[model samples]
Target chain A: MMESDINWNSIYEILTGPALWFTFIFFVGGLLIRLAFLFRLSRKKDRVIYNHFSLAWGLRSIFQWMIPWASASMRQQPVFSIVAFIFHLSLLAVPLFLSAHIVLWEEAFGVRLWSMPDGLSDGLTLIFIAAALFLIARRRIRPEVRILTSAWDYALLGITMLPFITGFLAYHQWGPYEVLLILHILFSQILLILIPTTKLGHMVLFFLTRAFIGFEMGGRRGARSW
Target chain B: MTSPTKKKFEFENNTDAPVDVDRVRAILNANDGARIRTWLSICSRCGLCAESCFVYVANDRDPRLSPAYKFSHTLGEMYRRKGKVDRAFLEKCYQIAWLQCTMCKRCSMYCPFGIDVATMIAVARSVCHSQGITPKQLAFFSDHCDKTGNHMGIPVEELVDTCEWMVEEVEDDYEGVTIPIDQPDAKYMYTVNPREPVYYPQDISYAAIIFAAAKESWTMPTFGWDCTNLPMFAGNRTLAGKQVKNVYDKAQELKAQHILITECGHAYRSMAFEGPYMAGYPDGKPPVKIKHYVQLLHEYLRDGRIQIDSDKKIKEPITYQDPCNVSRNGGLWEQARKIIPYIAEDFRDMAPNREHNHCCGGGGGIMPMGPDYKPYRMASGKLKADQIKATGAKFVITPCHNCFDQINDLSEEYDLGVKALSFKEIIVEAMIVPDHLKLECEK
Candidate 1:
């Protein structure tokens, strides 16, 4: 590893520097906007569903499920779900456990973490890109799904594949890798901003919904608190 | 796409025709008014409801039976073509209407958006009502409720006579129990589901015994004492309203304290929630405070009026199946929960209990919807059966009559070996009638 031996041409770096600004501006600003709206909901349904038996245990279970430590929902449909599950698992693992991403976290956020080998990271990243594209194609190709799908669904799926596609290309310094890399970071940042806003809100909202059902149904029925 | 064969199920009344379309739509519009517009607009079609529906679970993941598909035939078409769809499309809607569902709201519990598929199907039924393609069974029952003041065609004489009979039975257990029907100044004119009078007369007996044991001030009206509504279940709102007004007028005539709907899902729903809406009364938060049987009984149990025998408890493990109309439709869970454990000793739970519990596979008039979906009914029952099997419970304590019917049919056909009993049956089995108990409230 020879430091400062290789360099991007001045103009290319200049082009990418503007992209960095785009990433940072949207990433920070969009996150704030997401949080502001989410917190602003006037109705306090949280109290209704908040299990009082053990608040800490409930929160721990919720956090574990959201992080999805050993979740079994995907087991409901094993064959179809495994590939997607593996892809999701690896996508999460690679983002949290990649040497490059890990190093970046330490640089920017002052966090330290272990990372996987280069081959493992590369393989997982490839799986994520391939699996995402497969899902999109399957969605378009399936008639029943196509009938129910909306414009936002297609756009969302396409946006999801962007970070993976650009990230894969950005690796190995292939065609347009540097440019694609900036786009990858851009899309990833956009996804972070979207997590609580879009249907991706399913991540935060499902537990709330489940807990609501459990609590209301239980209380109304005079069962012990959930 | 095609009309269902009427030969599958024998319908009792055929003279009356289905309502005309404009009138049907007008009735639905009057009831829902415009809420249908927003609810239909927000469907994201996540398909979690498919997992929840009995038909879908029973049919091995067939996309056609999914509630989303069923709705697409009617509400879906209305939305997609901006209501400009052809008669062929409307005809397809009718087939999905009569064949696919019984209007049970089990799917709504799983819906992330809380879209009431049962209500939408009722809209389709109202559309069918307009087309004059109403099912013979529903039209008959609705008409029966209209003309006879009860869906079973129980005449005023027979209704009073049944109550008189109940009064006599209660005299055996309690000292001065008097079960009066149509008496002029009674505080309550209790209305029972037609099921109790027609197929399960003993259910009425249990209610009477319990009512007497509590020494409560309640009476049954000779008219409006039958609470079952075919039109509500069949999805005809005009007929549903007419069906409801029969009870409302009779209850009003008696100037009763509260009309306690019998242990039937649709009856309680129609009376407690939809009845007020259609009869020019308030919505679910009604002024009249029409109580469910569970509410009445639970209150009686709570106040030390009606008590069950803890020693008389069924030795077998018993679990409850919550009917959506009772638990979710009206949000009356406390009453049932408080009362259920008192009736049985070995209380167990079926997985996904309460509002999340699966449908009885016979609500929304699926029992009368026809025999065309009987296989689907049994198949869907497997999910519930599996849930019960997990609990290792021998009996399922379902409060609603149709739940008893559907679960009984499935248990018999599928060898579930699980007895389906009404809360009354279990309660009566364990009831300890006080020797000095009197019918008249001391108040």
Candidate 2:
């Protein structure tokens, strides 16, 4: 009924409709292309990996790294290891199983999946925010970390944290709730689009690398990469 | 600082060498395999690799010494610039690749993605090597390998002469001990680091004593006697390949069942694991079975081929320096550990020993890089010094010549008051000489 309300509604509609679809396609398709390219390149240039490939070693390498304190390096830097594991866990869980996110996915796909309890999701979101800030502070405070940190690293971190921050604020009605929701969707889409184009590609590339190294070190050399 | 009175081996930078952009691009393109491309693409620079790097920890935790920073700034920058990097940039790459990191792969275990930073450093070295931008000492050794089939440029005649020399010394203790040269159909065709023949002929005598005591059917190859491939450390892969092939072909020619490498770390890694791959064997296997000295030592003790005299076992506290190539890359850590307890009464394992052990900072051909690098080398070796000091062991035994030399220097510099030794040195002391092999004086 109000003019500003109508303006926000139209903007929200576009972001959720065609814009959201475009972001989803770009994210999934770009990642698939990257995976395909790396696979083809590996086949051509590094046949040694395929020759020595072992599913057992590869899976073991991945799982060992997945568990906290399973690696000596992880054990050496206890704080960083704990924070990193928690940060990654929250990054994956909150995005997929948060009730609001599930509702959106179900609405768009006409499909439904289990959603985590709202309280738990909220707690994870807060943890994600805190972990992200801690990581940024570490990058700033630690000399070894500080020298490697670039403006781009800080920018990427900001991009990753914005959606959660805005969502939290919007959920508790801290500011213009509709504006915050729209900004949240926008930031989430931006983050998705950037995944395949930036260092965030590690989300998937990590597994392939772990597997390759696992084969080279474990299967061939009888040495564990992890 | 190196004393001016001490002759410098010179870092051997060809400052006058022309930096051909085409050559740079070609080298980068050739090395830009899936591993490099993907690894360069995905490093988020989380800097967890800092603590994993001994150099970083040793150099007052300098971030520039971080393994991630080292490779990322060197090869990653080269790839980012599409190999259009200038001579100045390539010089920096040379410093980072050769001087900063040891290519030990300790950081590889720490990387969340399991990124092989050592591989990247190798590639970076290759790139620098293309432009005549390598440490002079390593380059000279690589050239020696190319010219004489050994790192020290020792001719086949000299290798035979040294074996004879070692035989004369060993024969006084073990009557029948002989350093057999180029014998055909031997069970194991043994090889030595060129350093043994040049600086430490006693090591050859020790090997002869062990073989005599064990009655091991081993023969040394006259032409391919040198197992260590400094070319690999020099980043000259072609030369490295040829060096490995010499030993591999010699073993094949002799009809030897196995090629037994000496108590050297890089020699085992280059000759066993990396050499076949460099020589175009994708499966990473040479035709003949390759065995490290550690593996053979373990086998001899386990099968009772050579018995360790209980009374002669080392009584003082001792520790084993796990060479990166021998333990981490070669996976003979358990074998080395098993050998230690058999030969020593008290064995104190270094904290973060085995696959996770820090490099002694003399690898990647740094020891061969000579006196100019001694200052930085000793500085980087501080972590290893501290590790040795913590064990409070009087004897620091290593299966690697590079590690032995570096640990010796660390002891001298850090005042650790430890005697650096090799596996052969300990075994020769503890091994019981057989009745038949014992000299008449002892009998």
Candidate 3:
């Protein structure tokens, strides 16, 4: 079909309907399966008992290390931490608060929420792009990180940044508006599909990994991992 | 300084050794649980864990020695290969998991993702052990423990003789004191690292002095007297389980209410924490209470069971080395800090004290790797040596025996002019025995 003759309604329906649900199912279901597998594996015959168990301590570690200046990792690598903090903050904020995302959520679940100003959303998207560039540059320049940088690591970074880039272009109508919108939806969908399977799984696994270490260090070892 | 008396075996250069890819794969497959999978998938290669590792830092930030790199290359590679690795690669895995890394868990403390890199390395060691590709010394020590119930292979007669010798020394210094051995119905059964009797017999004497001063009813069993478990470090889980089970059974047979592990970090961690788990006990809880001597010393001081003559203090500045096992892993940092000030007038804290302290490079059974690996091991302890040097302390007190040995080596190698002493030794030097318990000549 010609680009102008394409039926936009059907495409939007497919993108928001079966495709969205599929991504959600795969992301959530795959996560649950992985978590269950980890729990089962931990139940081996010979298990070391951690004498101390403090839910408060574990939770404290989670929040304590979440801040930019709260952890030694952040202090040791300030530039990376700043970029990473902004990247993660924008990654979460721009998606959840953008007017378009709020509209989608309202339509899907019949819930209305506050939306971020378009200017703020645009600025966050720009920061996200800049952070992604810095991370890529770091991977290329820093010898230690350079050695560990694999093809998949670069691909994950590219895949994650694509949606934001396309979404920004579409919002400003800088590129072909119709094509950019379609590409944004497609890229986001690809990310969702890859979330549980690839390094993108960090999005879900971060909490579990942090909690495990926190509980281990706080309750059992009587110290914080941070 | 001193070289290990045992001759080194040339395992790494022996390329003719057979490779058991199937057995390696089986072990890898068995260990491919959620923990390993999550860690492998989640690490973002941030390189933050490098600073936390003494080996990585001491090696001038070499990426190859970083905890992340070590795990990714060895365990991560094994997973990628599905354990169908060649003999040469397995040998490299042995070096990375066993020799290079001390499995100190300090990296876990600094990891943003909180990944337990040490556990991953231990899993790699387990795979190596299955393939008969372990360090010769570690394997020999494991075999010794399996055959003779102690790493040193001290016969019961020799063990009794050593105890009598220690008892005689203690009696010569102080009256009305005894080293009770094989005494049933004691409140606590005290255990020692085999090296104590073999190389540092004075450690036994120091412990005897403390027990006598406290007037505690404790026994040292002839069987299962050694608490150090080489199998734990070698990642021989079955053998580790057997070793722990032997100690537990001995404690049960003697009807001791508690098992007091000496100033050995890994021994305390293995017995009180890992042992019960290895022996199929739920939550790793032993049949009886497991206590470290540091904890006991702290308690004894608090309860007035033992008195430290704060007046009789060390003349020079002193600092404490937090054992990775006892402080970071066992949460006994505060106890040592609390007990040190009472004994030393010039107690100074290491800048990154407590859980963040560097490993002494003697952990993970690296000490038993012998002289062939000593230069490398001592080199990896550069950060620790620097930390000690910066403190400018004349004495470095560490509660763990492995730390004691490693710190002593670091002191001698770096020419820091410091003496390494265990907490028990410090206590004996500074403790005040009552006149009633003192011998007439000494009084």
Candidate 4:
């Protein structure tokens, strides 16, 4: 090989090797997971046509209908609602588009979507970590919601943010390199498995329910879709 | 009256009391797990509902008084311990679920999230029903209703005798009006709360006067004649089911098209909703059609079946108290308001009216339970008094038995100098004469 063959990029080694193995496991594991989800769904009773369509649309609609900063409706104060709301929205925006997720996606399927720039990713990551921390603090603090909440629920939430935090650290190459990377992968794997099991399943289903509820209200009920 | 054979009139000790802890545990465990989503999923905990609740407003806004919290106290514990909760814990659950709250849906209307507090209470009551741990007061009245076939415990013979007496009284006054029972092929089967046959038998005459003026084919069945379903308040679904089933059986036996429940809150709720669901669509057949008497009369007046001779000649201003069960739960608040002016001339509007109107503190078997529940009753009824005072009405016209009981108590206890009047009482004052219409000739 010529001197030019010595590609000085450590990223080359990551892209060609370790990232590849991590991603192959993710794909096979993710497919197995989604297959189990399909099996579970198949056993449930048939959904009405509206449900099917709304749910399909609702799956992709978290960012589709962006409102101008969620103005407060007369009967509903969407302010506190917006707090948990942003915490969720940040979860979608930050981790799903982090540089690591892009790398994993490319390795898994040889497909690529735009990843956020490093500065934007870090800024959003910090904001998201802060928002999630705020939510955890609320569940620990607010008496009413606190009564309904359990420590297991808080632990589950804490476990969920671990992957994002660690992956962000991995991207920054902060702290012990191998340990943070392993923690990131382990937490991400746990989140992927736990997604459909808990009330956190509402994280996926609430969109569909909310959208359908909105459409039902707007189309037939004549109430404004909030 | 078939002489009201003594065999037909004895009260059974349905208590099965000295309750079996094991059986009670199994039933509680089963019911607590059955309707999980109805209790847990429906509540979104937006505190807007706090303002409309009688218990919350009356109890210094302790979160416990919030109907939502009452549910959490009971159902939450049942969930926490995974339904292996103790009988002692359940006894308290029974008290709060049955006594502390009136199963009113006023809060549901205010709930921006549409968390139905009444549905929660009803489900909680369904649990209590399984436990046989209902309030002693509700239990007593329900036992009396089940055994004697009427909450007032009027013997079957005495009930028939009173009906016959009303027939005689109506004849002497209107000339040829007949109050027939078990009349085959009648279009409507009318029932009143046992309140009439026992004490205010005059109200029966008022009803008779209305029916006769309209010349409708109606009947009252003496076999299973009472209409008010008491087991509903007691949270005794078995008895409620039997009572409602008996109504359908009697109606079917008489070949009646529709049976009308009296102006009793629990009665209408049980017969109109619970009964149908309990014995609904047997073998996929259509459920029996039942209507509340208030709504039935509202339609009667609305469609010109009955005409008022005068806006009841009373001079005092009257404010209407909407029974929470009837107005909010039954969706008949407007219909109730529509019928009031037909019976009584002077009706002044009250504040926080319609579906938002306060409970009259008598429902959930509170009144018949007597005074043990009076403290909770007085505490919860302050909003009602405030609304009444705002109306400055001399009389409060409520078209429900429980509301009537509560309103009477509040009026006397508060010394508001206001009289509590039922629609029957007010309509009796305003009903036109059949003799004047030349409609009767039996004398």
* Candidate whose TM-score is highest: 2
The DockQ of each candidate is 0.08, 0.74, 0.62, 0.10
Whose lDDT is greatest here? 2
Q: Using Cα atoms with residue i matched to residue i, what is each candidate's TM-score against the true structure?
A: 0.70, 0.96, 0.95, 0.73
Of all native A–B interface contacts, model 4 reproduces a fraction of: 0.00
Residue B277 lDDT (model 1): 59
On residues B60-117, what C-alpha lDDT tens digit does candidate 3 reach at each position? 7777777889999999999998877887787778778876799889888788888899
Question: On a 0 to 100 scale, what is the lDDT of residue B344 in model 1?
Answer: 71
**Which scores greater on DockQ, model 1 or model 4?**
4
DockQ value for model 3: 0.62
The residue-by-residue lDDT of candidate 3 on A30-68, one tens digit each, is: 877776776677665213313444567667778867898
Q: Which tens-of-lDDT digit does each residue in B1-443 have in candidate 4?
A: 01112221111223434545455456455443212332354344434455567777766665556666677778666666555655566666766775677777565444433344564565556555565566666677788877877777778678778888988876656755677878988988887788777768887877777677778788877865677776776667678777777777888888889887766777766676556545543332215577777777788789877666774466778888888667665667778888876765677988667755678766766566666567667777776877787788898887787787777778777777788787765665676654543434532
Model 1 RMSD to the real structure? 7.8
Q: What's the true lDDT of residue B169 in model 1?
A: 65
User: Once superposed on the true structure, which residue ranges of model 4 sit more than 4 Å away at CA?
Assistant: A1-195, A201-226, B1-22, B28-34, B37-52, B79-85, B106-132, B171-173, B280-286, B309-318, B340-353, B415-417, B431-443
Model 2, TM vs. native = 0.96
TM-score for chain A of every candidate model?
0.67, 0.95, 0.91, 0.67
Ranking the candidates on TM-score from highest down gives 2, 3, 4, 1
Q: Mind giving the per-residue lDDT tens digits that candidate 4 earns over A1-226?
A: 5645644355445644666566556545654564465345433421221332344333223333344233122124345456555666777877667666799678767888789777887887787788778777765665545555557767877887897799788878888666677677667657755654544544534444444433322232122223
Model 3, TM vs. native: 0.95
